[model samples]
Target: MDWSTTIATQVAQIPRSGIRAFFDLVTGRSDIISLGVGEPDFVTPWNIREAAIYSLERGHTTYTSNYGLESLRRKIVTYVENFFGVSYNPLNEVLVTVGVSEAIDLALRALLNPGDEVLYHEPCYVSYAPSVSMAYGVAVPIATKKSDLFALDPAALEAAITPRTKVLMLNFPTNPTGAVAPVETLEAIARLCIKHDLVVLSDEIYSELRYDDVRHTSIASLPGMRERTLLLHGFSKAFAMTGFRLGYACGPEPLVSAMMKVHQYSMLCAPITSQEAAIEALENGTPAMLEMRESYRMRRNYLVKRLNDMGLDCHLPGGAFYVFPDVSRFSLSSKEFAERLLMEAKVAAVPGDAFGASGEGFLRCCYATAFELIREACDAMERFVDKLQKEAR
Candidate 1:
């Protein structure tokens, strides 16, 4: 039963995702209404799918260049500059990745040395902490507060820094909590990073999915930030293209160069079909994306109103499809509450604690499903909360 000692200790140290526990319990149960995944419920747009089919029909089955196809990389540049107000040289600065997941892994793998430190906020996406650890980096989490609209405090961020700090990760339009950072907060954080000479890894995959007229401002777009920021985005949530497995990173030539080495060995290229699909997602998918985003906004409005009506303290998310309701009034552990509701009411939500300790008193519900489904989930929660209240009395 002995294994290699390198994997023995390291693998044991990797934290099990709190979100995965629900699937472990409910797998093969046909009745679970899962709001746990942070993806749009819509299928990939037909036009994008057709592009993938076209690529396959053209016999593009083999691996592309280690940095990915040149045409796709150029499309990525035009898309970023046009949509995100951030520009990078397509030839030197962009590397297509297999989902933002692989872009993140590639960056961490290439940059971190053993015992280096990286910082990010919590109630974060499930990947950042363990992924950094996997790269032999130590993670330092700064607690973001709901009171501040889940804003990352610049003071806390500065305090978390050390001589060992190698990079900082930022994820806004965030997961579990649908919190987006305003430009001012990003500017302040950028100031500290510049002063301390830190690299920033900014994950902005949900930028296009915001509610209101709230435009997403990339830290990468701010003064002097383009050089230090490793910007990660993809076509998943924006274009309803999660299955396409295409993402890209934009950064300084040197960082992109270093990451391409890890990417070459690990992923080679994002599938050629997906790259073609992604290019279409960039070019022709804008109208579909706008429609999808507005649908998510309607669902958000509905769920937030219903949760508030039931006396749950839920807010309309600024971006992304999730609603993180403060469930402390029920006086239940987030895990216990989520499981009991899934078993009793057949509505599956992620426990906020799935993200981190600050997430302990909340439940994350993705409102990306059909309005009927969101209605059903809200109805189920109301009945369940009433029963809990009766029992408490």
Candidate 2:
């Protein structure tokens, strides 16, 4: 049986996620100290977990509305407005999905026609380009530079826009690089989006994980952008609810309705237990979330300092839990560095290129693991890096 001919061309061409592919090497290893996967080290707060349990006790295990539980949707709106300063009509504008991944797919399918271009920064989350391609849209990547703290340049964004461009996707406190756009830069990009009449997909999954008091500003909150942006967020990162797999999208009624149409037939709705838990998370999960955020901040500081002290040349990331350290001096490709580190040092970190081509000479180390494990990973990396530098000399 020739499976290649049977599968859709788009599905056949897309590569498996670079992050997952790298982890496959570590699957049987118990000795590895991993700073690879981006997920909270903390368990979900007990109170939030209890909510799910309580809901199940009450026999609330049935399906929710395709738009999700009305109570949860309202809570989502309130949380967004309070935290991100973005307003939405929960009744019509919010559609809950399985995860932010689903929201990304739904928004792209809702807004894109075949051949439409979606602009996003490079060295971004591995899924962005794949999602666009899966939705039959062209993924246009604008390279962001390490010299500029990896902030997205408005000029580059403007240059990437063409008549076929339909959407601008953004993830700040971004994956791999942990780049957060300054308010001024966001304003500039918002202006360009307005000028080009493009819709924006703002993924704020890591909004609560920022460090050093950095505030996350949603592009949807800017003037003229509220109507043109789809805000994607979920409980996975901040609330440590990755296994729950709940996310929601809030946007204009027409767009949300369109996404809901596809979602209704496909995903149906996020799990009822997860929706019940999410409501509790939005209402009273802040204290526990903040406690977890503080732990991540301490780990970030220690890991970043260790990387730089080992001569890896990492900049302090303003948000997110990952650091992209320069490994070019080792004279190895990102994959080679990552592989050698995993095999020789028993420390697992992702090759930067797993994110995008712009990440070629760097390595992404996530600090979302236990502090002791992080310390161990850093120690191993320092030894590994020292050997590479000595070998180069």
Candidate 3:
């Protein structure tokens, strides 16, 4: 019997993740050096890992409050305030989530009515558009160009707004493109959100990975935005706690309460052990994070120089470990370029189109791996480009 009709239409309609296909292609291949996945190569810092182990040793395995451990929540409050200058009430304004992924879905679920429109930048995280669709909302894409360093344009945002637009989903130090929105740009977008009376779901998982003396600016910290923004952050990128599956959302009491209703039923709470680890991450993980950020900065500098030297037209990423380089000179679609590079050079990078249609002529190379491996991948890529140029002749 065909199961397609029996499943929820939206679930059935959801497209498979574009990144998965590259993983499938290279799976179990020892020769391939992958720059595909966005995950950090570092293990969770020893202190944070030790804290979780100690928590288990103390027999603290039971679930904490549905809102997550009060202690953890309080630490989150302090972390955001001290780091971003944003204040949140731990008791009612913070809800722990399985990850920023879940926080995105929860915010959408809580705020969107059927047919409500959610506007987000394109060439964005692969999950953004699908998450909106999963919530039964209309997904609107705002195209950001490389000319602008992929920053969200206020005029483009204003043009996308309609009476039905309910939310503005933002990711910075953005994935794939690695662009950080400047304070002035974010301020303009915040004003547009305020003018349109839209909710802002700011995904800041990569906030700590910025480089070049640039600090991350959270839109939620702007005047009048605190009440309208649901800020999402996680331990995955900065703390190398991807396996821990922990994140949190902070916002006004009512919005946090609404997201909590969905979270309490769906996730119950983030894992107790992970919550314990996260407390340690917030309290004692800054030095480790700074070290990791510095490593990424070096890798970024090396990779961008190599790509530009090869005539790939890569911009210096302001934040995050990934670089989106324009590969149109190779006269190949993004997918074809990625496939050929994987097959020929055994260096794996994500096809930029995996991110969105606007990503068609580019490719995303993640520099979160070891410095040596990144250098090797660059060498391999240079050889690949040279071969293509020779072939053109």
Candidate 4:
């Protein structure tokens, strides 16, 4: 039996996630100080965990509506309206998902026809391109630069637009780079979406992790964007609920309904227990979220300063837990640099090009690890870099 023809071409073409191999390499190594994965080091807040337990205790274990629990959906409405100034009707405009991952997949599947184009900035989360491909849509990369703090260039976006362009996927408080799109940039992109008649899929999962008094502005909140934007968010980053696998998509009725159709058959509904827990996260988890955000801010400050002081060019990340530092001076590809750092220093960081080609000369260090571990990783990295410089000499 020839299995080559058995596998789908798209599945075969998709490269394995670069983040996963490093994670596997360090899985049981106690000596490795990892700043690789974006997972939050914090435990889920007691209140949120308790809510899930309470739901189980009350025997609320049956399948929820395919759209998720109505109560949870209503809370999601209130939560988004309060935090993002966006109004969503719980009944027809919100769909609970397993994670923002699933929400994104559902949106692409629901929206894109064959050969349609999906535009997203490069050095983005690893999933965007593959997800677009799986949906049979073209993944268009818009390169953003470090000099501009990785903010999306509206001119670049405008030039990328074509008749076949169907969606604009955005992740801010972006992964890998930790760039946040400013209100003006988002507004400009929003206007272009209007001009092109493109649907927007704004993944704001890290919106709660902004630093130095920088507030996250959701593109969906901009005027006229609400109807055209599918906003994806989850509890993983902000509420330390990564294990719970709860997330949602909210947008206009038609888009939400379309996504829900795909979600219903594919996912049915998000876990009932996780949905109940998410309600608690939105309702009573604000203080805990803020506290965690502050911790990340402090770590971000320390890591950026230490990396720059060591002669690595690192910019202050405006949001998200990752910092992308340029490593071109080392005269190695990002993958080679990461491998050498892991082998020589036992300090694990992700190779930036894992996110996209535009990420070739950088590395992503996640600060979501413990502060002491982060400091240790920084120290190890500095020594490793010093050794490399000496060798070059």
* Residue 220, model 2, lDDT: 89
Worst 10 residues of 4 by lDDT: 211-220
Which candidate would rank higher by lDDT, 2 or 4? 4
After superposing candidate 2, which stretches have Cα over 4 Å from the reference? none
Model 2 per-residue lDDT tens digits across residues 101-133: 999998899888899999999899999999999
Instruction: Give candidate 1 misplaced runs (Cα > 4 Å).
Output: 3-6
Pick out the ten consecutive residues of candidate 2 with the lowest summed lDDT: 207-216
lDDT for 305 (candidate 4):
97
Compute each candidate's TM-score over C-alphas. 0.98, 0.99, 0.99, 0.99
lDDT of model 3 at position 185: 94
User: Per-residue lDDT of 1-393 in model 1, one digit per residue for the tens?
Assistant: 455564656558887888786668877887777777777889998999999899899998988888888998999999889877898899989999999999999999989999999999999998899898889999898998878778799999999999999899998899878899988889999999999999999999998988899878999999989999999999888888887878899999999999999888777778888888888888889899999988998989999999889888987779988999999887799988998999889998988898989898899998888889888888998999889989899
Q: Which residue segments of model 3 deviate by more than 4 Å?
A: none
Error of 3 at 312 (Å): 0.7
Residues 1-393, candidate 4, lDDT per residue (tens digit)?
889898999999998998997679899999999998899999999999999999999999999998899999999999999998899999999999999999999999999899999999989999999999999999999999999999999999999999999999999989989999888999999999998899999999999899888878898888889889999998999999999999999998988888889988888988899999999999999999999999999999999999999999999989999999999998899999999999999999999899999999999999999999988898899999999999999
Model 3 TM-score (2 dp): 0.99
Local accuracy by lDDT, each model = 0.88, 0.92, 0.93, 0.93
